[model samples]
Structure formats: C-alpha cells, structure tokens
Target: MLVLEGVSRRFGAKSAVEGVELSIERGSFIGVIGRSGAGKSTLLRMINRLIDPTSGRIALDDVDVSALRGKELREWRARCAMIFQQFNLVGRLDVLTNVLMGRLNKVPTHRSLMRLWSDEDIAIALTALEQFDMGSFAAQRADQLSGGQQQRVAIARALVQEPEIILADEPIASLDPRNTKLVMDSLSRINRDYGITVFCNLHSLDLARAYCGRLIGMSQGRVVFDGGPFDLTEDVARQLYGLEAGDVIDMPEEMPAAVVAAQAATPPVLAAH
Candidate 1:
C-alpha cells in the first residue's frame, strides 16, 4: 500500500499541493483528474521522489519514501517507475537499447556506461517490447517511430524495470485519438496483467471514466473528490473542473468492438514479476 499524510509542496509563495491525504491499495488502477494547474503532476512526482514535499509523509508499506537519499533514493525511483507526457527515449539509440536502459539500476554503472547488456537482459527487453506489440521495431531508432509507437517503447522500458507502481503524468496528452486509445489500452493491460498499481494523470474526463476504477479529483492544489466513476456525478464534476454543464466535452468516440478484437488477436506476452 501507498500512504500519503498531510502531503504538501510549495514553490516560494505558490503552493502546488496542500494537505492531501490518501491511502492507495496495491494493484489499484487510479486516475487523477483535474483542470490544468491542479497539482496532479506534482502529486505524482512527490510519490516517485522526483520532487520532495514541503511537509508531511509518504510511505510505501513500511518504508518512509520521503526520507530516502542517494542510492536508496535511486532504488526507490527504480521501484516506482514514471512515464511522462513526452516519451523519454534516446533518439539515436535503437529501440532495444533504449529499453535496456531500464535495467541500469540493476546492473553495475560501469557496465551500463559501456553498454554491456547480457543475453538475459536482452531477452527481458525483448519480452517487454513484445508485450506492447513493438517487438518488430527493436532495431529501429526511437526518433524514427511515430508518437504512438515511441510511447509504446517508453512503456516497454518501464516494464523492464519490474516496478511496483507506475506514475504516468499526462501520458496521452500529446497523442491523436487512435493513439490515445492504444496507449490507454496498453496501460490498462499492464495494470491488469502484471498487478502493478497505476496512477495515471489524465486531463480527459472520458478517458478517466473509461479506464480507471477509481477517480481522484483535484482543484487548486488540493484533492476535492475521491470516488468511483459512478459516484462522480455531474455536480461533482462541475465542482472539480469548474465548468458549466454545456462546456463539458466528451472524449473521442471509442471503438470498443474493434479494440477488443485487436486485443484478442495479439499474442499474449506475460511479464515476469
């Protein structure tokens, strides 16, 4: 389980997050939703230790995640992997090599610097790429792939880390509608198949409603609502997004049958826990 107690962060006079308290169980698929500047990204960054909180505590099971430093902090980051809006991949490197970078924390620094990836590690990377249906692009340069494909490579890299939690910050914000569906479906599959806790920061209400089992609504650097999809009524949504009923927009149309058929046709590629 991951617990946050009175967690808050501030930038000079500006507060990013304030007095947030949450108890997230393992294997849960949660979507953090809000308007821009609602502190959604800051919250995820704090959990991943990419940023420190100004006050309060963050704990994963028995460990005090907020106090970790140096090597311990690096290990924590490895365990709680992060995916971003921009797919962070080396442009010049082949897809396989980019995926292998996830194993850096597991290998000696010198070995990583020398790019000495073992057959076993290569196999692991390959398996991850296969899981995302990017196995055929292993030898291709990351920059050469389309946005959706590059994001899949980024996900494959995250999978190779064998993380306990995935903190995705606006992962699909830059993708087209079809690519958005593909990325979201891939994330959903990873959460379902691997039992990894997923905390996705999403701007699209429809996407959150479609994929997440639970929704956390934030407003002005504070958690305003926490409940399931059905529990988030129109009034509650208005309060969260500060929008009138007519202004609320529906997300792109979903082709459920086609998505299901595609998923069914793909060969199942299981990750090693």
Candidate 2:
C-alpha cells in the first residue's frame, strides 16, 4: 500500500500541492485528472521521489519514502518506474540499448557505463520489447520509430525495471487518437496482467474512464473528487474542471471490445511485492 499524509510542496511563494492525504491500494489502476497547473505532475513526482515535498510524509508499506537518500534513493526509484509525456529515450540509440538502460540500477556502474550487458540481461530486454510488440524494432534507432512506437519502447524499458509501481505523467498527451488508444490499452494490460499499481496523470476524461478503475480529480492543487468512474457524474466533473456542464464530455460506459479482448489475452507476470 502507498500512503501520503498532509503532503505539500512549495516553490518560493507558490504552492503546488497542499495538505493532501491519500491511500492507494496495491494493483489499483488510478487516473489523476486536472487542468494545467493542477499539481497532478507534482503529486506523481513526489511519489516517485523526483521532487521533495515541503511537508508531511510518503510511505510505501512501512518504509518512509521521504527519508531515503543516495544509493537507497536510487534503489527506490528503480522499484518505482516513471513514464513521461515525452517518451524519454536516447533517440540516437537502438531500441534494445535503450531498454537495457533499465538494468542500470542493478548492474555495476562500470558495466553500465561501458554498455557491457550479459546475454541474460539482453534476453530479458528483448522479452520486454516483445511484450509490447516492438521486438522487430530492437535494432532500429529509437528516433526512427513513430511516436506511438516510441512510447511502447518507453513502456518496454519500464517493464525491464520490474517496478512495483508505474507512474505515467500525461503519457498520451502528444499522440493522436489512434495512438492514444494503443498506449492506453498497453498500460491497462500491464496493470491488469502483471498486477502492478499504476498511477497515471491524464488530460482526457474519456481515456481515464476507459482505462482506470478509480479517478482522482484535482483542481487548484487540491483533490476535489475521488471515486470510481461511475461516480463521476456531470456535476462532479464540472466541479473538478471548474467548467459548465455542457462543456464536460461524458465518457463511454465501457472500453472498446478490442481493448478488452487484448487485455484478456495478456498473460499474468509476477509483480513486485
């Protein structure tokens, strides 16, 4: 389980998050939605230790995440992989090499710097790529792939980390509708088949409703709503977005049949405890 108590972050005089309290259960697929500057990114970053909180504590099980430093902090990060809006990958590097970078935390610094990967590690990286249907592109440059394929490579990299939690910040923000569906379906499959806790920051309500079982709505750096997709009525969405009812687009009742079938076919993997 993950717990946050009275968590807040400040930048000079501006407050990014304030007095936030949340408890996230294992294997939950959660979507954090809000307008620009709603503190969604800050919240996810704090959970991943990419940014320090100004006050309060964040704990995973009994471990105080805020207290970790140095090698310990690095190890914690390895367990909590982060996916970014702009798929963070070395454009010039081959896809396989980029995926191998996930092993950096586990490998010796010298080996990582020299790019000396063992056959087993290479095999693992290839398997991760295959999981995302990108195995054929292993030798291609990351920049050579399309935007959606690049994002899949990013997901493959995260999978090789064998993380306990996956934090995706606006992962589909730059993709077209078709690519958005592909990426979201991939995330949903990972969350369901592997039983990995997924905390994603999303801009589209429709995507969130389709993929996430739980939705957390934030406004002005504070959570205004927390509930299942069904509970997010038009009124609640208005409150969350600070918009008129007519402006809020209603989400579909169910995900596309293809996405559901794909998830059903995914095989379960052992996830971190």
Candidate 3:
C-alpha cells in the first residue's frame, strides 16, 4: 500500500498541491483527472521523489518514501517506474537498446555505459518488446516508428524495469484516438494481468471511465472526489472540471471506429503475474 499524509507542495507564494491525503492499495488502477494546473503531475512526481513535498510524508508499504536519498532513492525510483506524456525514448537508438536501458540500475555502471548487455538481458528486453507486439521493430530506430508504435516501445521499456508500480503522467495526451485506445488497453492489461499498481493522470473523462477501476478527481490542488467509474456522475464531472453541468453532460460515450479497429488488430498481451 501507498499512503500520503497531508502532502503539500509550494513554489514560493503559490501552492501546487495542498493538504492531500490518500491511501492506494496494491493492484489498483487509478485515474487522476483535473483541469490543467490542478496539481496532478506534481502529486505523482512526489511519490517517486522526483519532486520533494514541502510538508507531510509519503510512505509505501511502511517505508518512508520522503526520507530516502542517494542510492536508496535511486532504488526506490527503479521500483516505481514513470511513463511520461511524451514517450521518453532515445530517438536515435535502436528499439532494443532503448528497452535495455531499463536494466541500468541492475547492471554495472561500466557495462551500461558501454552498452555491453548480457545474452539474458538482451533476451529479457526482446521479450518485453514481444509482449507489446513490437518485437519486429527491435532493430529499427525509435524515431522512425509512428506515435502509437513509439508509445508501445516506451511501455516495453517500463516492463523491462519489473516495477511494482507504474505512474503514467498523461500517457496518451498527445496520441490520436486510435493510438489512445491502444495505449490505454496496454495499461489496463498491465494492471490486470501483471497486478502492477497503476496511477495515471488523464484529461479525458471518457477514457478514464473506460479503463480505470477507480477515479480520483482533483481541483485546485485538492482531491474533490474518490470513487469508482460508475460513481462519477454528471455532477461530479462538472465539479471536477469546474464547469457547468451542461458542459459535461454532452461528453462522448463511444470509442471511435478507428480506435476499435486498432484494438481488434492488436489484442493485448496479458503479462505473467
């Protein structure tokens, strides 16, 4: 379990996050939604120590996450992998080498710097690519792939880390509808099949409802609601978005045909628990 007690962050006179508290159980697929600057990204970054909380504590399974430093902090980060809004891949590197970078913490610094990976490490990386149906692109440059394909390669990189928790900061914010569905499906599969805890920041209420088992609504640096997808009624959405009821009532319910076709073309691979 992960616990945040009175967590808050401030930049001089402004507060990014304030007095936030949450208890996240293992294997939960949670979606954090809010308008821009609602502090969604800041909260996720604090959990992995990417950003320090100005007040309160963050704990994971009874370990004080806020207190870790140096090598300890690095190890904690390895266990809690982060996926960015922009697929953070080395464009010039071959897909396989990019995936292999996940093993940097486990391998010696010298070997990693020289890109001298063992056969077993190479096999593991390849297996990760296969899981996402990107095995054939292992030798291709990351920059050459489409946005959807590049995102899959990013997922493969995260999988090779063998992380206990995955924090996705708007993983599909930049993708087209088709690519969005594919990426969301991949995340859902990872959460369900591998039992990896997933905390994602999402802008679209529809996509959040479709994939996440639980939704956490934030407004102005505070949690406004915490409940299942079905519990997120029209009123709740309005409150979450800081909009009038009519603004949210007209939201789309169905996935695009392109997204459906993409999903059909690539059935998600269930990761081994």
Sorted by TM-score (best first), the order is 2, 1, 3
Query: Alpha-carbon error at 233 in model 1, in Å?
Result: 1.5
Q: Taking the candidates one at a time, how many backbone clashes does each contain?
A: 0, 0, 0
Residue-level lDDT of model 2, residues 157-194, one tens digit each, is 99889999999999999999889888888898899899
RMSD of 2: 6.2
Worst 10 residues of 1 by lDDT: 264-273
lDDT of 1: 0.86
Best prediction by TM-score? 2
State every prediction's TM-score relative to the real structure. Answer: 0.90, 0.91, 0.90
Off by over 4 Å in 2: 244-248, 252-273
- lDDT order, best first, reads 1, 2, 3
Candidate 3 per-residue lDDT, tens place, 172-273, comes to: 988999999889989988988899999999988877767776778788888877776656667777776655445434455664553342231111111111
Give lDDT per model, in order.
0.86, 0.85, 0.85
Question: lDDT (0-100) at residue 93 of candidate 1?
Answer: 99
Cα lDDT, model 3, residue 174: 86
Clash total of candidate 1:
0
